[model samples]
Target: MSINPNQYKLSDRTARLTAQDLLPTTVSAGTETREFLQKVIDILLDYVKAVNDRNEKVLDFHHPEDMKRLLDLEVPDRGVTLQQLIEDCAVTLKYQVKTGHPHFFNQLSCGLDLISMAGEWLTATANTNMFTYEIAPVFILMENVVLTKMREIIGWNGGDSILAPGGSISNLYAFLAARHKMFPNFKEKGSSSLPSQLVMFTSDQSHYSVKSCASVCGLGTDNCVMVPSDDRGKMITKELERLIMERKKMGHIPFFVSATSGTTVLGAFDNLNEIADICQRHNCWMHVDAAWGGGLLLSRKYRYLRMAGVERADSVTWNPHKLMGALLQCSTIHFKEDGLLLSCNQMSAEYLFMTDKQYDIQYDTGDKVIQCGRHNDIFKLWLQWRSKGTEGFEQQQDRLMELAQYQVRRIKEQSDKFHLILEPECVNVSFWYIPKRLRGIPHDRQKEMELGKICPIIKGRMMQKGSLMVGYQPDDRRPNFFRSIISSAAVTEKDVDFMLDEIHRLGDDL
Candidate 1:
């Protein structure tokens, strides 16, 4: 009788769930359905129970074609049954599952915190918003609390914060807030009222997001002056000061200076103390893009002197998803000055949010943020924090740093194989696959440039094998180094070792 009678139906969920005419009017959760669900629960429970067991045959379930097929957006409704979906997940989607797999040294953030994943399931089911206190009181309060914790770590006393989608948007919020503090007239009349001569400075080694912000802010990408970097990719403070003085002498109003902490390619933290002094002297807004290093702010012993002068900056962007291993889309932009974000993106929504100014009108995030109907991304992170506690995240950070050190130590002890490109700064250890093709080369500029070409050849072989994955990028004129981000709490030394072995094996073939 249609497999089962009672099912998950639409009329219950207006916003997210709806009925489909092409398919069954309702999904079954009847007696048969209960039996099916019990079986499904048994399977999922087994998987979770076997989380630490990596030698299982379930790892080899999905072939290349099966994975390629799964990427397709649309297919016949009910074409993939719940049983089939479970089988595929247990088989086809093996490596992608973050079980701290020994060889899965691929992405920036890896490792499944049991708590984080559990929170994710709850959050997806709840599906709330962070726009107003009347709606999401708990999450809204948590956002403020978490942001305040970050601000306190940054040494700010009474600063404000707003959560954003990612690090890119977090940096954008900082820029917008700074712009509001500096040039409020632009909000009233747009870029026409502001000086096109307004310039910003970030290192040649800094993120592309800085230049992207320039593009979005109408300052033009050309205005994002790439200050020279040292061999280690940290921006030269003196050189930055020189550039600022030169820009000022040339009558360019230097508005912002973007200093990076644990940069993408090398995990290099710029001299924030020195940079902050320059920004303070020139009355320019300083923004520390600490998306990569912000997690370490929780690690008192190891946060380093990286963000020493952070409190002096006008704003800072710290993304928990990248470092804290909260789920994706958990980032925040904090400011020393209060209400700048509200003042920047605020619009008089007379038909909706505004008009009743007598009430607590400061009760909206849509105006302070670039997105309306922003997903309630806070709960996954807040619940994770609640479950794990701040101390757990701090220990996770310490463990990652320790893991990064282990990678460096293992690579450095070897003289001729993998080059420990830079010492483990934060959680990144960039290195290269020193293939036999470029081995024992003459110490000349020509050979140095030739070393740059070896990475892509080796990387191509790695991908073709379809076994392991680690991102590679050339940064600050260094020979292309494989950038290893130990952002995953699931990763261990064994994974790093396997990653190195894979790189070596692939490079030897090349």
Candidate 2:
């Protein structure tokens, strides 16, 4: 029995079919698959609608049995109805706590950008890796384009860049790149070959990532000197220079300097121009961790001169997720030289993925990255940038700054009940809640120092109210301050106004 030529006989197509079968059998957008997907989507939409409708009652969705069962998965199991998945998710949503909702102020993270969220869905579905030009051709090129655009904005004369998993890793890469620039031999010979006294510097106001970088790079966390900052949280440029000189005089290698465009506690911007000059003089690598304030790059209203010296730096860490509102894990570690990253991270995966280099063995992105299979995080960022364009982003940036200023004003207007402290560097407002009951405890440090132990008291009340969320903590650099991060594009004047009212109202009866 011969099959007709057009009848599509099964020749040994088993290889292709077998490969397809090996992958998790996800439904494609075929007739049946599309219906299943639609069902899933519809179920999710309804579930979201339900939560939105009865938001305050969402605690019921927090059942952990569903979680316990999901964790119990051992062998392959048949797929359940989309309804079952939706129900399980709804259970999770009970504790989900809507970050996108206007009320979610508890985190530096905030509401979703709809377009970016949809882009993330597309990225997940595609799930391409970001190593080289072969399999991830589109994403790799987009990475180059987006990073180059940022470089031009950062005032670079054609810098090289790579996408890191997060701002933290981006900071780590900056440290490594600076180390590579200073001691290129260190990569090949390890830290043992370098001066034992190598040290780096950051501001008292900078992110903890700098300290983490020191520990990770074998410089010892104690080796990372925290320079003092001015009252406004800007780096004390004089102190910084003195610290560098001190380290150098001790026969220690001062190889890197990190300036913050936006600090964690107060959103402080270190004097980048001044710090850059110091780094230039000391022959140290200058890295700007603009993970928070880099979003200000989109704004003519705020990019300010803080970013002025970024391009002069050996590297930068910019996370679009923080202020630009892209999905999480969308950060870039860019270098002034083209091959520095690859030089720092290259290994011979030659046994698996490389060629003699006489011809383009294109499908490899493994060399320049620390990760072997980095998920495609570029699409969401690229998609958001595309949809918003530079202008759209600038508008968003300007508006957020303006709203922040507005929030500050409203908070200050209540000088009696709430004490708003600190000028914003990237839209974080710091304050303290002094209820009438606690006011007698004396606002003096002698009494406040003891009260610091009972911080859980008011935080618990705030949590129960659920009217809004704000962050709290105490640091030695500054007294106990509640940090209010304005990261959501959805935040309006009403939301901030309500937040102030809630803080005061909660404190009043407490």
- TM-score, one value per model: 0.85, 0.86
Q: Model 1 residue 308 lDDT?
A: 68
- Show model 2 residue runs off by greater than 4 Å: 1-32, 46-83, 351-353, 356-364, 438-443, 446-455, 477-479
Question: Scored by CA lDDT, what does every candidate get?
Answer: 0.72, 0.73
* Residue 465, candidate 2: alpha-carbon lDDT: 59
Residue-level lDDT for 319 in candidate 2: 83
Question: What is the per-residue lDDT of model 2 for residues 1-510, given as tens digits with 9 covering 90 to 100?
Answer: 111112221223221232123224634424434443554455445444543442442122223676565442333356543434434444444455666666566666676777788888888888777766667777877777888898878777776887888888889888887788778898878867786689999988789988999887788998999999887788899999999999888999998899988888788887788887898888998898888888887787677644665666777888888888897768887787777887888886865466765436533657877777788888888999999999999998888888889988887777666666676767888777666666656457764554454345566666665556677888775456677878888888987887788777766755
RMSD of each: 5.6, 8.1
Per-residue lDDT tens digits of candidate 1, residues 295-315? 878887666655667667788
Q: Which candidate is the best by TM-score?
A: 2
> Lowest-scoring 10 consecutive residues by lDDT in candidate 1?
1-10
Can you give the lDDT of residue 346 in candidate 2? Answer: 84
